[model samples]
Target: MRSSEGMPFSVVTGALWLDLVYTGGEGDRSCWEALHTPTDVAAWAHSSGVVSDPSAVRIDEADLRAAHRLRETLWDMANRLADGKLPTSDAVAHLNAVAQRADPVPQLVLRSGVLELDRGRNADGAQVLSAIARDAIALLSGPHADRVKRCAATDCALLFVDTSRPGARRWCAMSRCGNRDKARTRRRFEKG
Candidate 1:
């Protein structure tokens, strides 16, 4: 049980992947805007008071684009469910082509001279997208794995790692998004 648990954590190396897929960062620009109302990712600010920590955030615009690209890539890889068909060699070949065209990940370890697509920061402070095949494989099979989900809050599209106490968290922000949602209804009834 312990060893199996470690594998899921390994799949969560960076916050980038989760931020990209589960949030409105998944190329749903209109949804992103509606959720923010007058503010968008460009103008919005990270709430330092709420977060109180720096290491946990990965939702800036560049990370946003990277996450969307990865989401599409992953979607193309294996089918959406465990019972679904395994990824064909042809599918991998296609993804590799797409990864190469997008950008080369650092790719520190290549077994057979094939480009292993890792993504995110490299030691030199440059972005490299290599050597991620193993981690990606772990992500699909690990316990932390899921089909990914968007926030259910109608006006809040922020995403999260559902490492919830019961694996059921519904909002990106309870005080902000969730509270605002409740307040809007309260005002409506009072006005009527």
Candidate 2:
């Protein structure tokens, strides 16, 4: 739920895995590399709502690499679904393996006079990644599997779950790609 500028592929899709996959970007010049370092991974986990404390998470080089690998596999599967195809067996197996990792232990915390579930302070990178893997499994296998779609914007390769009531969502975000597209169309009509 962060700002689009902070994370281009924010939780508008309501899937942590999609947000992780989107950290890479659409392979365009504006692509965002949010997982460049261990610290970056920690920051992403915190900002993506996976972890409550970035400093409490210990991310090493191996964890960073693993995150990249998981992100790539998720991205591949998302692209497949977006293209009206199913994910490959190997990708599914990879996702299953990642999902098997130790998950973060949930702790009820009192925040602003409300109790909410938050990950334990000892939550590591693997645990955070496992949470994302589980989210991917749910989104891709549950009833919303068919709702997965790619943004209609030609320049944007972002994938999002169509949570609209009619399931007719096209752009990644109305303020971002959708507005740009509408403005583009308006300019074309005006010129004509």
Candidate 3:
């Protein structure tokens, strides 16, 4: 598995719903640059754990486009939630269309003395997109709907679920936005 660092997707959000929104950053810091080609899509799917076997999955330009479109819709929906407003009707419809596509059905199997659940061996790009759409829907309608938030960093547009006990998480990641904000605060104090 590839680390979140250097990958086109940010896995630091701790939830697939937020991670999908983080795919395209705010302003000019977008991370979907690597998703322009089929090969890049395959790499991102593998790194993001969207597909268990990247070697067997096939992707094309259409699939890449659909994935990007879904990413954008998800971003819009998440942003609306962060603003304490409902997701746009178009965004909901788009998510529903993707969610109704080829979704992976998990099956339980007994291997030796252990029982394991699997989404089958032939997971494809559509299935991955469907899974992400379902996750977004769940987050939008679930109990934690009010907990979804955008990062506090002035220039960062990443979204995250505030999973802390007190629900006071600010930055997307402590090592990234938190550290940067702290440094800026220290500089301001020194100047004062």
Winning model by TM-score: 2
Candidate 2, superposed: residue stretches over 4 Å from native: 1-11, 25-31, 110-116
Worst 10 residues of 3 by lDDT: 1-10
TM-score of each: 0.39, 0.84, 0.78
Q: Which runs of model 3 end up more than 4 angstroms from their true locations?
A: 1-11, 25-32, 105-120, 187-192
Task: Tell me the tens digit of each residue's lDDT in model 2 across 1-192.
Answer: 334457443338757898888677445412567778998988899887888778888889998989999988988898899899999999999999989977778789899999987764788788888889999998888878888898898887667999788899998888788888999999999999
Error of 3 at 33 (Å): 1.4
Task: List, residue by residue over 1-192, the lDDT tens digit for candidate 3.
Answer: 122465332336756756655455445536445566767766666666666556656677888888888877877777787888888999999999888867655567788989875552466777878878888778678778788788899887667888788889999777777887999999999999
The C-alpha RMSD in Å for every predicted model, in order, reads 14.1, 3.6, 4.2
- 100: Cα error in model 1, Å: 12
Could you give candidate 1's per-residue lDDT for residues 66-115 as a string of tens digits?
43454456544433332234656764664454334322223344658775
lDDT-sorted candidate list, best first: 2, 3, 1
* lDDT score, candidate 3: 0.73
lDDT for 19 (candidate 3) = 66
